[model samples]
Target: MSPAFRWFHQDVSSRYTGLLCLFAGLLLPFAFAPVGIGLLAVPLLAWLFFAWSDASPRQAFRYGFLFGLGQFTAGVYWIYHSLYEFGHIPTPVSMLLVVVLAAGLALYPAAAGYLANRISLSAPSMRLLAIYPASWLLMEWLRGFVLTGFPWLNLGASQTDTLLAGWMPVVGEYGVTLLLGVSAGALVSLFRFRSGYRWPVAVTLLSALWISGWVLQQQNWTETSASLSVSLVQGNTPQELKWDPDARTKILNSYLILSEEVWKRDLVIWPETAIPAFAQDIEKFTQGLSGLTKLTGSDLITGIPMVEKGRYYNAIITLGSESGRYYKRHLVPFGEYIPLGSAFGSLLDLLHVPMSDFSTGRLDQPPLKVAGQLAGLSICYEIAFSSVIRAQLPQAGFLVNLSNNAWFGDSIAPHQILQLSRVRAMETGRAVLSSTNDGITAVVDHRGQIQAQAPQFIGTVLNAEVLVQTGATPFVRWGEWPVIIFAILLLVAGFVRSCYQENQPEEKTRG
Candidate 1:
């Protein structure tokens, strides 16, 4: 072939590579909730690694960004329903914001690809097996907390239904993410090196990882303390009705009517903002509910907004024998409060979101003492951040996440939250009770199995008995630092090797 023809062919191949990267990202969400074919995860990520391998640093960055753009756009597109349908924003603007958010998130993966290529390792096998995967894990961890974080759709969450979830109790979600990336990297390595030792090593590593996960899964890290009967009430209140002042009475009645039968149970849960009014504004009404709880010998946990002095907080308050109040720690940026400063504060006004400017609860607050055990508390978006839930572990007997999914309308957002809660359960060795305002009101046992669930768009109650766990998983004891530090060390070691290569004398060449 002529030199010009070869150049044209290479350029065309690169363009096709870019398109394939975007296609991988678009289909990635099927590996997650609602659809939940986690078997697709390894193949999808394998394609991404393969695409990144042959690209220059700049081309790799673009490919990685497009991949992330596609993944995030599909994974969290339900935000459009909240923004346009509930926030009352114009359709075009709502979609534009979603696009812009996806674009911003894309930068994390772009940085991963750039760093991986810029610090490319000398050994082909090492680069394919370790360097690419470490870069991906580091970026994934960064995405969870920087600028108030949106850790939605984490790769490990997809593994909740897969055998790899057995690794969650040992390594936590991020560790599982690293393992998943490594699995993807192994695929790329297997194809790149077809001879001798490297192929055998790749096969051994893949088989060992999966076999260990299966083995680790049979070992129970936590033991049952007591079996407690719990009921989760699904009010199914429409987002419009919950926020409207005139409909507060109807919404309040719906919950009250639903709970009347379950008050005899040990603990009854109401979804986020189930009261739909400030606690101070309904002091007497709250006392009546408190009285009812005392009468039935039960503890009732309900989401309500509270005010103290001048600050507002989204809180879960318990009434009856073991009473306590736990406020939400992490709040969603636009949905809960405005970030940065006053310039963005007007979004609440334009969007007309009720009780949107909530002050964040102190991170030091202890788990709530309710029912017969200490219950770790998370409100809505808080469950998305594994670290937030991790902080309360070993001490709290179980977990409870109060959510109002009505704002998301008929979208995968509801199911995704449930997926995150399952990951949280396995990581902490505690059963997670997910109580939502609409659909997916269910119970996830400590092993991350769904015990039972109520269908969405219905006013009902789900009753199940769960064992309160008494011990912590390895993930809870050591946290995510081990995996993160491992990734950091890999990059640092690569940098040192590159420096050594640069400092070495070049061999003399004959003229």
Candidate 2:
């Protein structure tokens, strides 16, 4: 075997091997936003594929789970900060929650590793190139969908700032995952066959993909129609003070006072729950504000909780141009609405968050018309769902993402979310207006590049012009169907080949 492939012979059950896998996973998050070194994912995943080589299903599961546990434990440790510092959970219980969540997420990778090895072909080329990538993406797809999903820390997220990001408008994030997996598999093949004829071929193919991405990045999938001047208000209200009765008026006044200067602009936006009061409770105030904006021909959009028919909803309302509203559909688990609320009702009492039972919005709500452009609204966590973003389509000229990230403090969660919002802009070929309470309030162009931004932990307003994009990218049209179908086919083919190989050896032994 080539020296490059020698690692494949290492004992999977060895203590040192497990440690190395854990370390690899720990290093994975640095590849994502706020520390954007995307190339690290290639070698890390290659190492994982090598460790899985020649391992039993059980051994593969253990190695994969360890990697996942380490990955989540490091990547999303911010959850502990939110739960304890913000949710008011005890320190020990918060730590325990993090551990349990990490362990649960680890099972996806464990299942993927088990299935990969169980159905792997004997040929090194086929096993690493086809089977491994397919299995990995299948797990990623499943992870994104199962139990309302928590698609954080996806491998493709690391590629957001790299050349691979260009593939987003064409195939969306999952398609980018498939491309990334193929690159990792190629890296493994290149190393495993260093002395064979295929190593050079792998090198050529890898270079082609990277170069193709760069070329794709140069093309414009969506056309810029008109530009609308906008102002995004960042209240920067502390989470502790947000729900306090005395602070409610202060928060509303702060946003209004900030907008007083920029109300002449085509559109003005506020962060999620900027009002900190129910829509009906503030009806007279909203109506007066709406009249003022109408007189000035300015459209004002702000986040506020709404109580109608005795059901509360987390929603955004537009008060000018063409009046409309968008209620958030994909509510945050526990934060917005508790999942399995009946069973977890007692547990939710321990959480300090307010209005934790907001009802989901209708799936078919139309985009709000702001300054003659259709604006798709995503309140906080809803931006993480690509399908929900894509559903707006070519009709919604640009996207407006309103969020209150103060709950996560200064952790990487907010930065990671900003990164995801950028990807969403790229995927749909629309400029994104990402307005937040505490930071990262920015204007992203159609290409997913940040044009302007506000600093975190400050009360400020971001002023910029976003282009109305008209054409649709391939991703906006097809969504994840193509890549998903391709992954399923690859998995089936890999297992069929493995079955044939298993039978051939038995026939020869019988002869």
Candidate 3:
């Protein structure tokens, strides 16, 4: 065979391997729904082994990037639905846009792999196992924070149903990612190459850590407060109809009918913007609902549009209470408010979205008091951000997310958004109640498992007794500080070590 042909074949094989790893990572999360805990770790371990074998830093990065592309492509394929259905883009253009976004996201993982390779070059022994995992998590953290942050598929989310989920409340998802990556890397190192028993040592340590997680899972970390019987109303309204003047009554009636059936419950919740009108305009309607809440003695939290001082907000209003107003702080760019309006104002006209100039609320707004408990309210897109939720944790006993997923239609967007909410619930050790206009409305426990859920595109109400954890979890108290500090320290140490090694002089023997 020609040398050039051999090279091409080898490159294709490497890229294919990377793609497989990416697919495996994406599939790993679904496995938790049915597969045993023992089997769930196999794919991750395999990916780590692949990384270990790719001694070339460039090859390792390529593999990691391809893997990330596949994972995100599958996980966020629903993004195209929004572009096509609402953005009024051509189907092909919409698909291409989604692919480009996925590719940009994939870069973070590729960068992480490159950094891990650099660290491994310095310490190729079992020590690389620890450094690689820490560095990879640091990259994930950077990805979450840098440029408005899109932290969709952190590795720890895959273990939401496993005993390892117990670690979530203590360390948060980023920490869990660190632990999982380290364990996977150590396991790969232990068995893949003959390394003078160091591999065995690493594997034993990881096994012990896994056992520790099992023990922790059995412990009740927080005292549960009085369970609140809550009803989540999913209206299943289409995005096009949600804002239509003629369909306003239809949207309102849909939620009212579903909510009336469960008004006897302690609380009734509706997804974000379930009422597509401004608070001031809907005074009479809100008053009627308030009267119902008063009569039934049940608190109601529903999303609505609000306008104050010529500024619009995507907000949550609590009926039956004097303090019935909370505005969304973290507004979605383009969707809610356009950035750099001076330059992009014309783009809005092309996009053709109404109410694209929403304002942000204060960062330190108090949690909504509902059904005798303080519930943190994150409107739609805000739940994707950990810092926003972390800020609300101090005053909140549980979490409530109001989202209108109608824009994304019958797409995976709702599922992907729900997954992020589950991670937030696990991180804060708070029961999360997510109500959506088009569905995936569900209650996720502190351990990140879906306790109960309303299926997609279904006009239904889910009634359940959700437990609230009174005290704060470790994640809530410290937030992501520990992980951030650890990552910074690792990067600094790695850089210093690299410098020292590079500066070291080569000693000459007697020639």
Which candidate has the highest TM-score of all? 2
| Regions of candidate 2 where Cα sits further than 4 Å from its true position | 7-15, 507-511
lDDT of 3 by residue, 1-511 (tens): 2354345347854556666667665665453322324346544644644454554678767766776677677767777877787889899998898889888887877777777676534455433466567767887888776876777666776666666677878888887877787677766555544547665777786787688888877766567877989999988888877789899997898888877778888889988888889988888998899999989888999999999998888889998644468999887777788889899888687777777898999998988788888989898888878889988776788899999887777666777678778879888878899998878899998667789988788899899989878778788889878987886687677777776776565422322
Q: Over 4 Å off in model 1, which ranges?
A: 1-12, 505-511
Give a tens-digit lDDT track for model 2, residues 1-511: 6763565465443446667888898888898878878889888887787777767889889888988998899888988988998778899999999989988998888888899999857677777777887888889889887988888888877887889987888888888888888888888787778677778878887898889999999999999899999999999999999989998888888888888899889999999989888988878899998998989989999998998788899989998877778889888888888889889877567887788998999988888888988999899888888988988887999999999898888899888888888889889999999999998789998899999999999999999988999989999999989988998899898888888988997999999
- Superposed by TM-score, candidate 2 places the C-alpha of residue 210 at a distance from the truth, in angstroms, of 0.7
Clashing residue pairs, candidate 2?
Answer: none
lDDT of each: 0.87, 0.86, 0.76
TM-scores, each model vs. reference: 0.96, 0.97, 0.90
lDDT of 3: 0.76
Quantify how close model 2 is to the true structure by its C-alpha RMSD in Å: 1.5
Better of 1 and 3 by TM-score: 1
TM-score of predicted structure 3: 0.90
Evaluation by lDDT, superior candidate among 2 and 3: 2
Number of the candidate with higher lDDT, 1 or 3: 1
lDDT of 2 at 38: 87
Minimum summed lDDT over a 10-residue window in model 1 is located at 502-511
